[model samples]
Target: MDVDPAASAKVVGNMPPNISVCILSHNYAHFLRQAVESCLAQEPGDYRLEEIVVLDDGSTDRTLEVCAEFGSRIRVIPLPHRGFAATLTESVRHCRGDWVAFLDADDWFAPAKLRTASGYLRTGAMLVQHWEHVVDGDGSPLLPDPHPGGNTSTIIVDRAAALKLLPVTNEKFFHVLDDLGLGARMTHPLTFYRVHGDNMTDRATPGAHQEYMADVCGEIAVRLADLRITPPPWASRSALRRLTWHYRAEARAHEVEAALQRGRRRSAWGPLLRELASTVLAGRNYRDRGPSIHSVLTGRPCVRLAPSPQEEP
Candidate 1:
């Protein structure tokens, strides 16, 4: 297809000042169209959105065609599968606006989101986030009202500030850790969060918590060092508790494996038993724990290890 030159020019010329919209996607064709249209539907003339950069993280679906339909209004950047962190960094690096906002392919924006957030653009505030309307798989409202949670829809950050704190999104350690510290370091009062079943933040299991713990511990370590706070006694105590849990978790895992070996019927107990086993097996020294299952379930990675599950063997 011959590219439209005039459309291309319009895309380049009407750059919104101070804010760029960046979308990261992978195989989200079904929802990608709505996401793009929602951003385009923002109150016209209310905000000069500089650019719309969609980082296609090696999507095999028709996501590219859907984005192309927007003409030159959105720039599609293709990337190898570097996971979430790296792809985000690419979008950030390519962003021309002073402020950067994010949208996932499977998610979208509220009509007034950008207009509402325009009040807080400055050099000092690293981020400006706000409440989001929760929805179901079909995009119907699930929550009665907006809630304070961290989804791309709820994120608007100072581009330079983010770069200074952490340069590369490809580094899993950097993205996960910085997100927690960054949230703690700043006050956010902008954007709307839309919760849906397909939303990335909704998926979590107790068994997956080891990954979550690792991310939090990593971020807390960075924050503590940044603030020059000595490690508290609870940190060490927690470490021991995790280690003890690891062995018991391993033992329980062995029991579950034995059960499976004996070919028991697969049911609620079967899944529960396996989940517990995975949680234990996943347990690493406190230092290695990354983002928590709660963070995975919730949009933001809040570090609170609820009482470790009872030891089973």
Candidate 2:
């Protein structure tokens, strides 16, 4: 694949690519190559893979070197560490396709990912996504299919629809629950989500995670207001309260783990009890809920309710 930027641009303009794949990287030099390779290897079918854009958000590692190795096959943008949200916003500007697909630096897509998604996206769907194979840092399967439609790596968004959601100011919330925010519930197992010690989710403290969730919920509220649609009874005030309780429960669960790590079994009991109580309360509140505010606003069902290996009894 000759990746001359000039020639590629000419080809893109002449042929008009069906999908543009964008990969965002910070410091994951070790995983960047694999991500890029996977995108490059996508097979063409109903839609052609028009371009692959790699943005390095001021990584101190050898990430730029890895991207340079790909040469003209990908458009590599070296940027300062302006954070994920900013990087994503800027990356979209460089995409030149009708549909945009995102691959996290630490994740990779299946060979048929584009082929599978193009079929649905061409049908006028605003967004399309698929299931993900969750693996450890070493690439060994941890959960064969943890999330059927929740991973951003699995998503393919209509370029125009994506722009409408962009310039997402909340750095913590942007790209975190993008699938839900864009209503990409329809899915197929077509991507890999790597879990590792250095992952953002793992690095976030319980308190930080709670704060991020709160911000996400607040954003959801604002979107709902914009849509001028009142949430149903199931997704109203009580639903928001229950969602907050779940975040608190997650925090308590982490505290219990910390206590156990310190060999303080007795100390862990308090947080354990609190976690259990919050879980019970949240469960009761969520019992009869329909689609959540996120679902309602995005006009898609919640992916959390999707069946996957992890959800199997």
Candidate 3:
């Protein structure tokens, strides 16, 4: 969480901007405390930790007890498990902060997370996502390498800008929002992402998660076409089925590549060669503003900025 000393010059007043740490949880009571502690430990120094709210959606466990343990340090909103995107929307409405930092209950943040993110948000990037430390269920680092991509816990956005993409961003496209015609940017790693067995994306079943990701991208590509952009060629008639074919083919290649990452497979050349062919053969500029065909096919990073909930998912 090292802030470039030059970033300090942009600090307007002694008070920090209103930044809320929104913890989205279900039955992850065991890890919830660590997530809460991570936020409580932060000293915004400039505006305030305006609201640290937990959108607990239909947990049949001791999740309520954990919130009570905080003793008013944070607010707990009991929701009836509408889904991930819906709870996130509730977070936007319930929070009073000008900037919202989302934290998944299974993960936590570094001590300087808020302090560092606040500085970068001033750079006028409406949506900012930092890196994540991929960890095991027990809060231990799972890999030597870090995930320099996006995660729910890393999205810190300007409230007003997020409200614009409300209706367009539904359950199918909530977390997949990378380039939704918004000014999105990336920063350093500060959040921890836990790959527990019960995660939303299945990791153990090989191609399971990759297939899900492919579908997510296909749906996004269709929606991206509906936006005020030049729209890609794949957005023509029967786009979902057609685009999904490309997405699934690329996803299969990525699944093999990922297997190689864990040292479970040795046949990396096939997938790598196909990836090369796809990149070289496919025309660039899948609508120019980028969420590029290459980017999606290669598992590249993207942004997720939802303007509102009652609007999108």
Candidate 4:
């Protein structure tokens, strides 16, 4: 929760923030309080918190009651269940701030998260994200997030830029890895990303997740080609190659899981061996750090290498 005073001062300057925070929730009433309180706790000095909006996507739980608990302090938008991208686009449309920061109902921000991010955004950066601390359901620290950018909770984006990139429909392109196309990454750990059994990403069958992710990568490539923009360091060929390895690893892992479920323990070895060979050929993207091939194959949380530091603008 401690922010470097020098770094804070450098971004904040004398300008007040014109920011809106949007929280997306669906059947997350259990964790909604903590997420809302975290936003309410932001101390941005002259920077205005402006509005905190919670878009409840047709929760059949106590989520609405939770929003009502805050009363007039925040804006609550109750809508029928629309999937992630549509809900996000709808929430963005409701925001009136110059900057928008998204927090998933299951995730919470660190103290001074908004203060620091707003300062950086004021410097004209199109997007800014901080490091994420991945944790378990009980809030125990699991590991430092290796892939920090593009997560909805970790990023703050310019309103104009977001509107252009995030679409209400045909949104798969902007769903999970959208941040790669946005802007810069900050090295500070400013958000807590909770990994639990109920998470949508975690709930997806491994094979389905892998296929969806591969499609996402292809879309990104197409978008980059169309725009004639160079891929950022994190999304370059090496990064995509690393992602490809993980996809293949996850697919093989799923095969092993199926074998074990069928009580064919010996059958798992063939896929496991193929996975090992792929890992050996992946080459290292980080010194002694690479994709968590074992974790993918075992249905455990996959650890990734942290992004390399980039020169600040």
Point to the candidate with the largest lDDT. 4
Each model's Cα RMSD: 13.8, 11.3, 9.8, 8.9
lDDT of 1 by residue, 1-313 (tens): 1122233322322333468998889888888898888888887644578888888989888988998899998888988877776777777788898878888777777677677666434212356555565555566655566555455556677676566434343222223222332322223333333344444431234334433333434443343343323333222434434433443443333333333333332422443354465455446533322222222233343333222112110
TM-score of each: 0.59, 0.64, 0.67, 0.64
Q: Which residue ranges in model 3 land beyond 4 Å of their true spot?
A: 1-15, 167-187, 225-313
**Model 2 lDDT tens row, 1-313:** 1122232222223333388898989999999999999998887776777789998889999998898898999998899899876887777777898877888899999898887665555433455666788777777787745566554577676676556445653332223223233233444578888877776652233234433444554564444333334442223545545554554565555555444434455665676567667667767434323223222334332322212323321
For residues 120-235, what per-residue lDDT tens digits would candidate 3 score against the true structure? 56654556677777777776776676677466787787776555334322233433233332334445668888876677655444445554555554455455435425433312
What global local distance difference test value does model 2 have? 0.62
Candidate 4 residue lDDT tens string, 225-247: 43335444335655555544543
Residue 264 alpha-carbon offset, candidate 2, angstroms: 20
What does the lDDT come to for candidate 4? Answer: 0.65
lDDT of 1: 0.54
Per-residue lDDT value at 167 in model 2 = 63
Number of residue pairs clashing in candidate 2, backbone atoms closer than 3 angstroms, sequence gap of 3 or more or interchain: 4
